[model samples]
Target: MGRIVALDFGMKRTGMAHTDEMQLIASGLTTVATPELIPFLVDYLKTETVDVLVVGEPKQMDNSASESEELIQAFLKKLKAACPDLNVARQDERFTSKLAVQSMVASGMKKKKRQDKALVDEISAVLILQAYLDRKPFI
Candidate 1:
């Protein structure tokens, strides 16, 4: 089976993660500046076959859509148009960022690294992908 990819899309940077071909583990891939994402993905896809694209869906605590929803919707539309055959899915990402930060602190990362937004984004992507995988069997 082809690998799966996850995206944590943000205004300034986009975090990426991918599963192994066996679809077992989700690993943080990289963080790219927002402006570089499309070209980067387009090039990466040329050399890699991805079966699914999981995008983080930000939502409010009460389950209302967050402000990022609109941007995510636009990105999803463009993603579908770019890769019509790939399955695109969304997973709620309410606490991924906070979880990422906590994880970094627990890991004893330096203050600078712990505060790195890009690193947090990448970790959040991994968390998002893991959440999606956990739900797949039920779906």
Candidate 2:
């Protein structure tokens, strides 16, 4: 089976995560510059087969798409053009970032370290993938 990759795309950076080949476990990969994300994902696909690419879709409390959706939509066009055969999907990312911060606090990370946005981004990617996995009952 191929890995199921997840991305938490941001303005300046994008956090990446993936599941094992068996698709049983999820883990953070890394956070890369937003501009380089397409190339990075292209290179990643060369090394391992990826069944799906899950992009986090942010939503507001009232369930309307967030302003960030416009950015994500633009990226999606580029992503599809660059990786024509790669299957892409979207998952709700409503509270993943907040949850990531809470997880860092619960894990007893130092305050200075917990403030690292890149790390939080990476953790948020993992959380996004885990949420997708949870919703996929047959996976």
Best by lDDT: 2
lDDT (Cα, tens digit) per residue for candidate 1, span 1-139: 8888999999999999999988889999999998788778888889988888898999998999999999888877887787777788889999999999998999989999988899999999999999999888731
Question: Once model 1 is optimally superposed onto the true structure by TM-score, how far is the C-alpha of residue 133 displaced, in angstroms?
Answer: 1.2
Clashes within 3 Å, all models in order: 0, 0
- Candidate 1 wrongly placed segments (more than 4 Å): none
| True lDDT of residue 76, candidate 2 | 96
Model 1 lDDT on a 0 to 1 scale: 0.90
Where is the poorest 10-residue window by lDDT in model 2? 130-139
Give candidate 1's TM-score: 0.94
Global Cα RMSD, each model: 1.6, 0.8
Task: Supply candidate 2's per-residue lDDT for 112.
Answer: 99
